[model samples]
Target: MATEQKILIIEDDTFINRIYKRVFSLSGFGIELAQNGEEAMAKMESMNPAPTLIILDIMIPKISGFEVLKRLKGDVRWQKIPVIVMTNLSEKTDEEKALNLGASLYLVKSDHNPREVVLKAKELIDKQIV
Candidate 1:
């Protein structure tokens, strides 16, 4: 039931968000969007049955994506939701930091093609479902 798979995307850029929404939709995944970390958290709190996965952007307004990841990892209910960190920041330190903070996949937006990113995300989600 891949179509039933719900994904939450927390990104500040409207263009990027639209791109992601289209990508996931094309892949038959149910997608939800949040403009900021705070809005993402609020949406998570109210999401029915929770989300299967989360696509997070490191640099965002209101609250940084790292803070959101930290909070999600701390909460038992949401801790199990696999997070794919998608950011333009390609530093080794940043990637390590995100992994240590509980991100399941850390992807450099500038390095990977959109299809590759989507494939990696599907792999993570499939692993979790299995």
Candidate 2:
């Protein structure tokens, strides 16, 4: 069998993080969790088989999602990883900023359920079109 696709979620909210883990688990996706940008960076560096996708929250405790996106985009090795910015911040500026920073997609947390987000993620991965 082909290996399961891995997904990394960079989120600070403990409750939401656990929920996403369960959701992705049931969907046959290997999952990794990072509470903040620092942890996320460390995880990314050590991931031998890098994750196929990343879901990043904009308002994190230690470092903002924007900063993380910038770092990932700035590095050639990590630049191709597809990133989805999942945030409750629905302002137009915030959405535009994330897209400008190389986020493949921007999702509003309040607007999408767990299932919806997972489906979207799968669609993105399947397309391979970003």
RMSD of 2: 1.5
lDDT of each: 0.91, 0.91
Let me know the TM-score candidate 2 reaches against the reference structure. 0.94
In the range 13-126, model 1's lDDT, one tens digit per residue, is 998888889988898889889999889999999999799999999999888999999999999999999999999999999999999999999988778877777898889877
Q: Tell me the TM-score of each prediction against the true structure.
A: 0.95, 0.94
**Cα-based lDDT at residue 124, candidate 2:** 82
Candidate 2: worst-modelled 10 consecutive residues by lDDT: 121-130
Q: What is the C-alpha RMSD of each candidate to the true structure, in Å?
A: 1.3, 1.5
lDDT of 2 by residue, 1-130 (tens): 2877889999999988898889988899999999999999999999878888999998997878999999999999889888999999989999999999999999998888899989998888888744
Which pairs clash (backbone N, Cα, C closer than 3 Å) in model 1? none
Candidate 1, run of 10 with poorest lDDT = 108-117
